[model samples]
Target chain A: MKSQRVAVLILAGLFLYLSLYTWNLRTGHLDALSNHTGLEVSSWVLRPGKWVADRATTLWKRYVFLVGLQRENERLKDEIGRLVLENADLHERDRTVNRLERLLSFDPPVHWTRKGGRVVAQRLGPAAALETVLVDQGDLSGIRPDTPVITPDGVVGRVMRVGLTASTVLLLTDPNSAIPVISQTTRTPGVAFGRGPGRDMVVEYMNVNAGLKAGEELVTSGLAGIFPKGLPVAVISSVERSDLSLFLSVHATPLIDAALLEEVLFLARTRAGEGH
Target chain B: MLGPSWWLLYTFVGVWAQHFFPGMDFLAPGLLVSLQEERRGNIIWLTVSWILLQEGMGSLFFGSTLLWYGCLILAFHLGRGLFSSTSVTLMCLLGAFLGALHFLFTLMIMRLEVMAFPFERVLFEAVLQAALTPILWWVAHQLYPRRLRSDERSV
Candidate 1:
């Protein structure tokens, strides 16, 4: 009887396995269901925990991590004082330039509508080869998948997945990430692909004779509709020619330090009919 | 007796822990509870819940957890005569072995190329999960309510 029961259980298990396998392939309803419920439950559970962590982190930063903060504040104050004076001089220069522009009738550059949100979670393990960070804003805040996520420093990444209350931003350093970029100095265009996490991105398909030099800035080529043109992407760190491959082996470092990103700006595209 | 609220709290904590600490097998408590109860209904419910939680949190293709739990149940039944079902050591060994097997099986089922997969990192996590399962099981054993303890002993 025991042997018969075991055989029955094995058969049942096999049946369930095959069913799930077929179901998984046919309709991705499982993923949609899991994603919705998982995000909801996880968000609810993490709310209180995040509050506690935030308080503890604030306390530590204010009391324990404040030793060097004072010196840093003083240095920043002096730098700000100098910048104010320089800004006044630049203001006069900008006025003269504006007059010249008006006389020449130059059109103003297009402006992007942007929203700000905080990073809530990160997918940082072996399961995800594509490095992604979850932000607290979603469709409710006009955050759409493929929206450019950036910071003051430079381009961070583009939104990949959007939930109801949260969304995942695929970092530029992810293996699957590719961006069309151009060398600021050489004006030569190439596709920058993420090698992996914490590794220098490679700019592939560039001609070996492009004479791309190290220290050249790489910016969005505007060819890809995802990112705005001229947004800083990476700085060329090395350029080499492979004997076997036809493409040049160019490496560049991402401008943004993804590890330290706490908050990001979402550049939401405005509809054509919408007023600026 | 542990009521439904207690079980809900336990599941909530288990899900939360699994989300934050990916490699840790929080499902060990459910496994222990099912084994101790020795009830077919209990086992089925626990297995279903575990599969749902794992599939929800896991970023991989769906059905990974189905395959994992299927293998785990098979292993339990096949080894029932080799060791007592209540043996914690056996549970730990099985947990470790199954953790590694699950990773390998999922990779294969997903059709992930070997060159692209992070083998070392996944292997390290699997091993860590194995080592940590016994500790979690011990914690679950200690925290089980008195009524459940009596019921388990009576069984």
Candidate 2:
């Protein structure tokens, strides 16, 4: 009799849970609730811990790691001087392009405003199945699903979920992530599909004679409607022609290292659609 | 002695631990300890909080955490019939069970959701979960307040 009672209780509980789960799947109310509460609380906890760690590292580096500081500063100064000359040259070219565009009556480009956020953690908790990182910015910071995340080096990923004050970024290294890309020089178009973490992503659908060579850069083609066009994504690592297939089996190394990501810039679309 | 305040502290520390050890359930051991102590109200609260936290952070659907803790509860109850509830051996066995469950449950959920399976990383985390569960349980058991014990309530 007792066993029967327990079994009935279990069945009833399962039924109720399933009903709730189904409702949540449809409405997404429960997911938002948990994100607002649980994800927010975790971010609050993690932020301080990250702050302390950053401060300690800064203090140590500033005070203790001074052996090569002078040499590094000299090197940085020379690089900055070179970059300033390059910047002036680029500015002149930009002015010429603007003049040419005005004369040709080309459409204005889409503008992106950048919001910076620090990565607090990577794939936290039991439910984090994807190769993801927790960024300390969320819906409040205009971070939404599919918002492009990038670094100075290259593309990072896109915002997957937004909580109140934190968001999850699905890294480009995750197998689920794919981005449309074009070769920098050859202009060969293909889709770059991630092949799990720590593995080079595969570029699919390019013709065997596409002329894509090793070390050639791949940039976002903006066909996905998420990432802006012409952002550096990856570099061609290996390209092979398979007799059985019409397309080249090409692999690329993502420009940004997911494991080394500390701070990322989230790109939000501008109101006027002019990104300089 | 375990109390509301202590539970809050445990949760704070557990969150930190979870941050350090990604993809492993740190609070499951606390639930196991709570079960051994027979704290019904605390059990419910902890389970709910943990479920929310795990589900919120996870990429899969919410029901996976429900199934995870549900299986843990069922295993604990069934194992209690054959072994002492406080036995370290029982915790180790439960930990191993949870480890295997993590792999199978994650794969099942990934399949259901049609997401790519992260076979090797999940396998590594499963082994970690198996090893960490009993150790965390030991830590929680050791740190539990003596004054809050049912036997010591009168004193």
Candidate 3:
């Protein structure tokens, strides 16, 4: 009888898993969960925790070490002051918002729309470098499938799976992560892929002879429609085309720290009924 | 059935160790223990959480981890009667087996993307798990002396 009960339990678990797997594969559970109710609750839950935790960390690092904190703040404030007049802050925020508002308002990019959700979690490394995270919202939150996640900084990743109250984010740093990127400076474009060993992203398909240089900004070209036009993705950190390979694998550093992400915004609803 | 307290101990230790060590994850061990305790129903959650934790540290999904660990637990638990109750050899074997299991599973999960990928995280995790499991088992045995001797030891 005991063994029978155990067998029944295992069978139930197996049933649950198989059903979910089948159900998700067809409907894109990740998208559903991200836009679901979970997304809504997380938006509210993570904020308070983040606010408290950020305050605590800032207080401890700044207040506990008052003199050093003040010095660092003074330096940062000086830097902000210089960039403030140049509209640096506005340029950063408006780019993400405006890009979404434009393409969605213009045409349904591939008959798809976008949903925006607050990033509720940031996950980091421990082993073979997964570089993924959990977002607090899912299908019920209007989070959809294949939605590109971004921040004022740049592209973070896309929604992978959405649970009832949570969703998994595949970070741009994982080996599975890939994005199309173009150089704003030289107009040279390539495909960006993450290698597990580092924080850098490798760009493939560029002309091996293109005058590629470091520190160039890379942005989404709006060709894929997965991302809105002209969202900053990364800065070119390297250039490499081995004699053995024809594709020049230029590496770039993602502007957003996927590991340190506290919140991610899901661009769900577009102005044209598809949010960028 | 494993006590809730024991589980809480297993779960929280992973968090505490991960918090302090900065570059360590003991979730595989917890998963192994869960499987060993016959909590097979919870294995999915275990594996999912383990995968999340593993990837959270920045790894690619290498398949066959659950298969390999399942085989190890099945082999170990089934072959338990051959070993003595308090034999050091038994402890050593357990440690060695666990270490090998952990290392192999780690490598499989880490390199799930590329075929025949070139890296040896398996050997690294095997050594770490083998070293750690025995010490942890020994400590648990000391803490719950009678439970260690009860019918649970039959496995």
Residue-by-residue lDDT tens digits, candidate 3, A182-251 = 8897887778877653457778788787788888899987777677667788899888767887667787
User: On residues B1-155, what C-alpha lDDT tens digit does candidate 3 reach at each position?
Assistant: 54555654654555445433323445545554454443455666656544444433332332233344444455555446686544456556767876665555545544443433324434554576667765665554555435534456675
* TM-score top scorer: 2
C-alpha RMSD by candidate, in order: 8.6, 8.0, 9.2
Residues A1-276 of candidate 2 have per-residue lDDT tens digits of 988988998899889888987898899888887788778888788888888986787566444434444456777756764565467658867975664444334222358777778888888788888888889999988888899888767889998888988988999988889999999999999999888778999999998888889999999999878888898899999999989999999999999888877777888888766333
Using DockQ as the measure, name the better of candidate 1 and candidate 3.
Answer: 1
Global CA lDDT computed for model 3: 0.57
Which candidate number maximizes lDDT?
A: 2
TM-score, candidate 2, is: 0.85
Sorted by DockQ, highest first, which candidate order results?
2, 1, 3
Pitting candidate 1 against candidate 3, the one with the higher TM-score is 1
Candidate 1: how large is its RMSD? 8.6
Chain B TM-score for each model? 0.82, 0.94, 0.58
Candidate 3 lDDT for residue A97: 69
TM-score per prediction, in order, is: 0.75, 0.85, 0.61
lDDT of 1 by residue, A97-156 (tens): 664444234221255667777776566222333467767887677777799887766778
